[model samples]
Target chain A: MLTPLLLHVSILGLAAASALGLFATRRESPSMLGSARILAIVATLLVLALQLRRGMEFGGLPLVSRFDTLLMVAVLIVGAALSIDLTRGLSVLMIGALPVALAPLLFAAAIGMPDEHPERNLMHPAVGVHVFLTLGAYAVFGVAFVASILYLIEHRQLKARTGPSLLGMMPSLETSYRLTLRALAAGLVLLTAGIVLGYLYGRQVLSGASWRLDAKVWLTTVSWIFYVIVFGMSFVPAFKGRRTALASVACFVIVMATSWVASFWSHFHRYP
Target chain B: MELSVVGVNHRGAPVEVREQLSFEEARLPEALAELRRATGAAEAVILSTCNRVELYTVRAEGAAGAMESSHWLALQRGVPDSAIASVLYRHAGLDVIRHLFRVAGGLDAMVLGETQIIAQVKEAYRVAKDSGHADRVFNVLFQRALRVAKQIHTTTAIGAGGASVPAVAARLAGKVFQNLAQKRVMIVGAGETGEFTLAAFHERGTLDPLVVNRTVEHAERLIARFGGRAVGLDRLAGTLPEADVVITCLGSSEFCVTPDMVETAVRARRGEPIVFIDIAVPRNVHPGVNRIENIYLFDIDDLQGIVAQNISEREHELARCEPLIDSEARRALQELGEADVHEVVGRLRDAQHAMADEELRKTWPKLGALSPDQRQEIEYLLKRVTNKILHGPTTAIKEAARDGSTPVNFLEIVTKLFRIK
Candidate 1:
């Protein structure tokens, strides 16, 4: 009963924070933004607590369930976004981050948790590291995706010469672009390490099973290549502003597809 | 005492008339003293800016005080009374409170929601205070007006965006760069518009901007006024790579900055972002330069468009600010009124106790054979009776004040009935 109540409260908190954040951006109100930030922090902490409880119940890291994965990703996104806001005074990013963080939780709620959890080997430390690293990369890329979207909106508004209030509430174009590149760089490094560890683990566990042909593996590789290209294009002068923002947005879509949609068809990477 | 404001603002007067009535800051103290003496005002503050010349005063309650203040302002400024008679406006009591609050909050500014007027108002108050013209009533009035202005700005989006061309240019630069102070700025002309743009940048902490003009002497003159190395127009290409922001207003028909030049600068800077603000009439920078990577370009029309949009937004916020200012003015008037009522109530209570003490003293001598304990009981009884007699009127006056009734008239009635001078 207590666990369910905590889950409901966490979800409600995130939903309220997302709503308030959007309103704050539209109204350009600092006090409302402050309230949203506090709500987001409380919700993020509750989500972390839920994850810890699940890990304790599973006797290891809770990486075998889709609900667990989504919850972990949501926590990381809010945590990273909050850290940036607090440290750098970029509270405007919360306008995008809060809604993005709430999406995964809402999705998890829509698809209820599996009744009988699939039993899997959770003793391998390498697998744990790989899962955690990969999810962390996704969360960071989610922030990059948000920054890219904000950059595009602000760029369009500047080009059209409208929406002064909206423009005032957004971060600068250069700031958003710089944030995208920073997040992409950090995500790229972590993803590379996670992929390398996952490859080693795959070879050890599924030897001679043609695991390389797995749909999840192919989609993950494609997303990784897209991110690599986006990161590389940041250095090219011709693709600096709008093109780079668009590329970041497209690449994150691919990342999301790889993580959620591609997992269903993979025989070896199934999660209940 | 009653509060009054009599003046001519931009809404009521033309520049020709306003300039005639404008006060020199150096002579403000003498003018303030003269104003008080002429109008028999207990306190006064003369706020004279480019757009308005207002004399705020506190004096005996009557229409005569406002009329006298208006005539004094025009006569002191050496303008004929007939010159400003039609344009002069007067507000007394609550209207005075509302008008001052709106002025301080920038709602009455030529540019709605502009912030400079707040500083100007502050300086005016400071002058009044230093000259000993600001006393209890003006002090409370001006301080509350400043606080209301701050609250309005903080809680509303009325001051969110730039409302002028030069300001919009700086705002555009801010959008393209994270930290403007560290960025190198290049001014491609030495005209008045260029100077204004440079001043806008300097206000944001970009002090040393490169001044480039066709005439080396002109560049040097600008450099002397604002700190920066002067460069001739021939060295534009050599210095282009070092500047993160370029503001051009050379008033030339030819394109001073072309795509080729920006491409070379981009290659030299290794793809660092650069913003070109071409505020020239014939367009100083080529339109094709906007296509270059890491280059953002805006012209005069673009800056004006943003300024127009920002001004419209500020105007829309006035609806939100009006109600807030109205409520605040009402609340401030009530508080100030309650303060006066409290003083009168204290006087009334003191008078009642004094009368009771006198009566008790006279009776105690008559009862010469009374014991010490009996005398003490009689003193306590006298004090309690005095308090009970004053309590009903005090409660009625306070309740009237709190309910937003005719508090001033009610306090007057109480003061007259009790004869509590």
Candidate 2:
């Protein structure tokens, strides 16, 4: 009851925060949005607390059910946004971040939590690391995507000499670039960790399963390669603006598409 | 006290003449003491810079006090009265207040929006203030002037962005590429304008520029002054693709960078964005090259356009600050009208203005679809109505404040309505 109730409250809190973020953006008051951001973070923590309580009751990780895994990932995304934004004083990012944080929770609430499998050790600790790492990467990329959209807006307004548009509510182009680098680094580290953990789990834990032939494995590998190229582009001056923005969005799309494929079709990710 | 000013600025005098009229920093106290004794003014301040020397005073004797001080100024500098009179200008009454406000706001600056004058004036005021040359009236006046200056800057774009041509170009370059240290800049000339532009980029940490000039020796000379590889003009096509930014500043009449050359570079870059800044007078790059995708081309005229736009945008920002200045100035004058007015009306007026600003912002977007003229008209109407409603009550408050006898209920009513903190 507490878990579902907290999730519902978080969904409402995040939605309100998003709305307040819109208002604060136009007003150019970072402080107003800062409060709403704090509220959203508090709501996120409540959802996290609920997950822990559920984990205690069920005698396993908070990520037992599919809904719980989705929600857990959503928490990380919110956590990433909160930490980066609070540190940089980019409270305006909450305009994009709150909605992104809300999406997974809303979806999870809609679908209901998946039943836990009896022999749950197949959902191994290595698998948990992979899942958490992948989600951390996804959340970081999500922020970069929002930053790109803001970058385009700022670039346009500056080119045209319009004084203060919605982009004024966002950070400067230089700031967006800094945030993009942070996201890129986080994505690279987490994705690399996920790949390392996936390999070890496949070799030692699930030997002779023919997991190498799996569509999910190939798709994830392809996505990983794509991110690596995107990572290289961040260093190259030629790959800024819409190109980098598009690359980040495209890589994230692959992440989601393959996540769906693995959940339904592949034996590696899903459990009863 | 009646306020008056006597000064010679860049407009009224040549720099040589202004320098002659100027006061040395060490002798400021002696000059202030001498001026006060000569003019019989209650208080005085002397602001002396390369561009201007202004003597400000408040006295019981009014206009004669200003002349007496000006005469003293002339005698001290060993200049005859006629020589001083050649450049001297005087302001009395409200004009003195307006002049000081304009000086603090940077409107009186030789370069519009230059901020150094405010600091200079503040320094002058501080000296006058600490040494007992300036007392209550001068203190309130200068303090209010500084407040008005800060208010103007906070509310306007006038002092917001870089105002110079090279600074604008550097800012533009900064916008295109975030890490100036990483990106390669190519400066394709070895002249004054080229050196300045290159230095601006260098200042931004775009350290290694590939210099390409018609004469490789000149390019090498520039490379010695500013760190960069000297690429020969003959091999420009090969080197062009390596640079994220290409600045063409040849003094020659003909086009230095052609459409074909940019096309070759673009193809090499796989349509990567390249910023082309043509600072040359006769145009170094063909205007047709702007047709290329991912190419940003800015000439001197284009940069000047940005400068003009920024100035105009800053002016728009100034438009917002003007009314606030007027209100705050009037409030200052009101307190001057009666010393008790500050103790009574200060907090209440601040609260009311805050409420006005908050409400205006909340309602601004609702009127967004209307034309600017229509919106401005509506704003005027709103301001007129609010001012009209407040005028009588404010007058009564000031009247009540003449001897610290403001009705307690009047304060309570306003505080309750506005929820004044």
Candidate 3:
């Protein structure tokens, strides 16, 4: 319960710090920006620690339920990101990294809790492999999605020729797009492997019921298909830049919607 | 004490006037000597660059001396006193100190935080010193100015983005292609902007440059600078196929590099990344070249947009540097103030010692008649009297020094009372 309390407060603090950073950046206040960066880093770490604790409690390992696993993944990504950013001595990114770290946790909260116990027959090593790889891909996708949103916002401001804002502190357009492409490429590979493994594991475990289309299974498959199209087009000789960025944003929208519906079903119907 | 800077700059005067005021490098040493001689300047440094010519001089006596020096400098430049006098900025004491600090710190640089100005100031100081013009006061002032410049460079983000259009172009190129050393750079023109880009690319060492211009001679000149070869405009179509980076700075009415030509080049290079930088005002490269597969084209507008953004970013960070400069400025001022006080006190103490020595010489024969013990006792009593006589004046002088009141009147009274010159 205190884990949830700490997580909520830390998220709120991150939000408030980002707001302050934005305001300071707008008003061109250096001290305010410095303080905002400090607040963002500390609060992000606090929330991450709470998630790590919860992850260990749930699974003994960091992965058990999808909820625990996603929370743990988000924390690790942000922690790694901020650590890299810290070396560059750019405090401006602290505010940029916060909401990106917070999105997954907030999404997890909106989704219902995982089942306390379930049938053990579906939990084979192969199935577990499939689940973990897909989860990992989704985590990478989450990072790409966050970066894409920032890229679009920055690109718009640049196009409008507006003055300096907090958004200007983000990396250049090409860097963001490259990061998203790399993330999506890795995620797509894992997703492909995961889907194949799941299909193979399902046939072995559930026999005739393996072919019975579950909404979650179809939704995941559809999102996976969109990612394939995105991954394929990205490597096309002419389709590397603005077209690739558009595809990534589109895939993100698809991934977000499908995941939302899956969480909805899991909450209302107690479906895995 | 008074200080004055009288000169014309690129912003204030036309090239004809600025060049007239400009001190050629060969003549600078003699010019500094002449400046000191004509004005009876205690300290001076003459900063002469193509963009600006400034004479910084210090006269410890009064404003009249500084004005005389400014007049001399104007006369040397052959400009009428009334014509150039309005732009002549004069300051005494603290204002002069602040103005120099700002100039040396790059706060007053045309391109903010440009490193060239500090070196320029040092060169001017050296010339003055070589010509026996820079005295102790000017030496201290210029040394402190250089140190403040170094401090700002190391401690703040003032020099971030390198404070130049070329550096900005290099940064943007790095972000786009991620590596410049492996790329081939083709310059479509041999103008000033093209030369700047060539320098940036050469500095990054990521690309082998190829210069192509309308005239082979013009292309040859730019190519020679980078130790690269030149080609005619006819070969640009062929060279475009192999170049990883193409930069155009030809101020042409029509496009020199077209989309159809780039489209062919992209196919020829397969899917290799190509970056096009157009720094020309009239846009030398075709806008539609951006549509070519695996080819990224950014025009002058785009690069200038980035430059504008970078400038604003630096300006935002300037807010952070403002307090840093103020604190450093205050520290510098306090140090100079204290040094002035110390100098005045040292002179006063020396004058006191001279008077005491005179009095002792007169009384030594009278004291010889006393016993040895009595003689030693009398000497101690005389030393005590000397200390007692000097104590109040020394304390008042030091207090006035820190209070920044110069203590000139008090110093005069003490000298008169002690009969010490």
Best candidate, lDDT-wise? 1
Docking class of 3: incorrect
- Screening candidate 2 with a backbone cut-off below 3 angstroms (N, C-alpha, C), the clashing residue pairs are none
Q: Model 1's CAPRI class?
A: acceptable
Q: Report fnat for all candidates as fractions from 0 to 1.
A: 0.51, 0.06, 0.16
Candidate 1, residues B1-421: lDDT per residue as tens digits? 6788999999999999999999999999999998888888889999999999999998855436334887787777788888899999999888999999999999999988988899999999999999999988888888999999999999987887888888888888888788888888899998798889888998888858898889878887778877889888999998999899999999798999999998999988878888898999999999898877668888888888778888888889999999998998898888888888789889999989988988887887678888889888989988898888778989888888888776446666777798988
Task: Write down the TM-score for model 3.
Answer: 0.73
When sorted by TM-score, best at the front, the candidate numbers are: 1, 3, 2
- Mind giving the per-residue lDDT tens digits that candidate 2 earns over A1-272? 66678888888888888888887776555566776887788888888887888777667666656787778867887887787777877676657778877888888899876554435664466676776787777788778767766666665655554432322445656667667767877787887888788878778867686887777777777777888888778667557555676677677777777776677776665544
User: Judged by lDDT against the true structure, how good is candidate 3?
Assistant: 0.69
Q: Which prediction has more favorable TM-score, 2 or 3?
A: 3
Best by TM-score: 1
Clashing pairs in model 3, backbone N/Cα/C closer than 3 A: B180-B206, B181-B206
- Tell me the alpha-carbon RMSD of every candidate: 3.1, 15.9, 6.2
Ranked by lDDT, top first: 1, 2, 3
lDDT (Cα, tens digit) per residue for candidate 2, span B1-421? 5678999999889988888889988889888988988888889999998888999998852235244777888898888989879789998755677778878887777766778888998999998988889998788888989888876775555675456667677767666565677778898887787788888888878758899987788887778877778877888888889998888887778887888999889878876667788888899889877766556677888777766766776666666766766666666655665663454466666666666667887998876688889878877776776677767867776766554454424445554565655
- Models 1 onward score TM values of 0.91, 0.69, 0.73
Q: List chain A TM-scores, every candidate, in order.
A: 0.95, 0.91, 0.73
